[model samples]
Target: MVVHSISRYLLIILSLFLFSLVIIECKSIKFSTSLSPKSLDLKIEKLTHLHFYLQAIIGGDHPSEVKVAGPNTSFIAFGTLEVEDDNLTVSPDVNSMTIGRAQGILASADQNELAYLNVLIFEFTKGVYANSTLSLLGRNQIDVPNREIPIVGGSGVFRLSRGFAITSRIRFIPNSSVVLVFGCYVLHY
Candidate 1:
């Protein structure tokens, strides 16, 4: 009988000791300064995609000299965004760097419905020189379908749990006859 009681007490003590240890570990905390106390809200301004396919046939007129421009041509989307009252800085997605023109445009519409626009043009010449056999390669220009557009601005409230909210306006330009389909995912910090 005495041995049984002693064993019971010992078991209780062991359980208590393990429970306290778990509580201590659970109470222990870690700190990081990389986080910001401020809150933010984000929304999508605009997202669009355009597909172009063209085939040039050599039939009636073959000039004495051959001329080749870029392999193909297409326009990209460009736009500006206003986020709430806070100042915003925009950066390029390096992976999006294209061998052809990549355009970014941001536009604003006033009460009168007049649009003011800003344009970013990335014209690449890599494909143009690929086939150098042609005597004359002309400069190629890719323009956005709607060169001018209205601006889109939005806001949403976010807290510590939400981390950062990102709204983006992205466009893709393909310079080939083959159908090119692309999907993009963005992660925010």
Candidate 2:
């Protein structure tokens, strides 16, 4: 009789445990966001990865906010500004940076070229990286007035191999004194 009673108790416990698990699993959820940009006006050929704080002087302010999408993935924006720091040199890790291939350059249906900056993921043991261009891509231009833009959809993943701080800068000289300073950064996985 005692053995039968023990068996009944075990069955009840197992059923209760399974029920609890089902309830928990049903309540759990997951979330995600798309990084594809509708439009990109700049083709940043040379990207110079700088210390988070050092980029401000040269117009490197990024996204206006930071967002958490998951436990391991988060979205944060650095500031945008342009600084002419001759002392600043290309990051040795990625010195020979090419925007067309490096940052994943691609063409849209409109024949508009788009470069994916955020998707450039690289694994680093905490070193610096940098790249530059003779001029920002002819078709793509960065206007300081347009402060915030989406980072997604491109030919390559520039900052995705590993988590690292990235700083992008551009210099443009028109016929006049209107020098446009544009830059931004991302702390991504």
RMSD of each: 18.9, 17.9
How many times do residue backbones clash in model 2?
35
CA-lDDT, candidates in order? 0.28, 0.30
Which residue ranges in model 2 land beyond 4 Å of their true spot? 1-101, 108-169, 172-189
Error of 2 at 87 (Å): 16
lDDT of candidate 1 over 119-161, digit per residue (tens) = 3222223443221111111111223222222222211111111
Clashing pairs in 1: 41-156, 78-104, 78-105, 79-105, 79-106, 80-106, 107-151
**TM-score of each predicted structure versus truth:** 0.24, 0.21
Candidate 2, position 42, lDDT: 26
Q: Which runs in model 1 stand beyond 4 Å of their true positions? A: 29-34, 37-189
| The best candidate in terms of TM-score | 1
Cα lDDT tens digits, model 2, 16-86, are 99999999987785475555433343243343332321111212344111222222321112222112222
